[model samples]
Target: MSKLFSITLSLLLLFQSFNLDMIDVAQLDDFLIHAQFHKQKYGDNLFVFISKHYGELKTQHDLEHREEQKDHEELPFNHQTCSHFSAAFVLSGADFTIPKTPQLADTLSNFFYQESYCHMENSDIFQPPKVA
Candidate 1:
């Protein structure tokens, strides 16, 4: 196989391993509800990272729909958004404690951001574009 083909095949297999098809509307809804609970309990900054990324996902989806000549309706959540939200939820802890202070909230936000960043950095699908 050519080097480019080999690399593409490896990346495709790595992406398939993520099993994004397992995400469903029901699961996404549940995550949103839980996110709302966390937002209220832990304050807005607690989920700042997830919310920012969610907005980006929405924008991308809108652009995609526009390109396809379709009306843009808000999607509940896609695999990428679901995965990010799930990661943030777990990083924040399954057994939740409301962060009572700004410092605590900041700490949680930082943790979520760092974890998500590292995950993307390590993923073949998220690698930075190569320079010519």
Candidate 2:
């Protein structure tokens, strides 16, 4: 992706997350109720109705954020280090042992020299079938 696209997408998601955090369903319900109240009281048109809804929403948000700013200002916090840093490490104690295996000279160790001797009586008995 291009750098500009990446930055724009990141910023869009960030601002959208903040917007989602600030707005709530209950707050929207309150806005709707107030809009209806204003419409009924003043018999305002669509323009006035939309204006009042967003106007109240922005005003309430501003007031809430202002209070938050004031609260943050009252805190006696600075960028100074508040606590000491601590670090710990342990030495690894690993022991490896390789077992020694005896190697065979040949893979076919099971096969050995066999005697090819056969009895003459056994060979005579192994004749072909004869016709009657």
Candidate 3:
């Protein structure tokens, strides 16, 4: 009976952990959606654009010895796009689907943290490169 109780307790703990992981994935999905919406409506504000375009800004500053004023180039949807305000406006309905759970992101982040020995990793191999 003690053995059975231990097994049941372990299973319950496992199930609770699994549920929490699912919640994290849901939160990540929500974050991606929020990013998409802000990009659509605000054209990537200061902070978001800073994070997204950090690479380019760094490179530009390195080459020119000056700070980059903006994060991204204006997309067709961002301004007057021939007949439309911007494509992001129309594309706003699309969902940002995360292929893996939030655990994946955390696991990957941790892996990179350990593997790179801190900032020794390449952004291109781990994350997306600058657009322009």
Order of models, best lDDT first: 2, 1, 3
Task: Give a tens-digit lDDT track for model 3, residues 10-43.
Answer: 9889876554444444455444554576578658
Mind sharing the TM-score for model 1?
0.22
- Cα deviation at 52, candidate 3, in Å, is 12
Q: Per-residue alpha-carbon lDDT of model 2 for 1-132, expressed as tens digits?
A: 699999999998986665443334335555556556656866876566564334455455346456444422322221133456899986678666699899868756777889977686567567877889
Cα misplacement distance, residue 34 of candidate 2 (Å): 0.4
Of candidate 2, the 10-residue stretch with the lowest lDDT total is 71-80
Global lDDT scores for all candidate models: 0.52, 0.55, 0.51
Stretches of candidate 3 exceeding 4 Å from the true structure: 1-20, 45-132
lDDT of 2: 0.55
* Tens digits of per-residue lDDT for model 1, 15-132: 6666534344436665566456546765645356255336655465346446422211222344344334333333644667787855444443433333434555678787878989
Location of the lowest summed lDDT over 10 successive residues in candidate 1: 68-77
- RMSD (CA, Å), candidate 2 to true, equals 15.1
TM-score of each: 0.22, 0.26, 0.20
Ordered list by TM-score, greatest first = 2, 1, 3
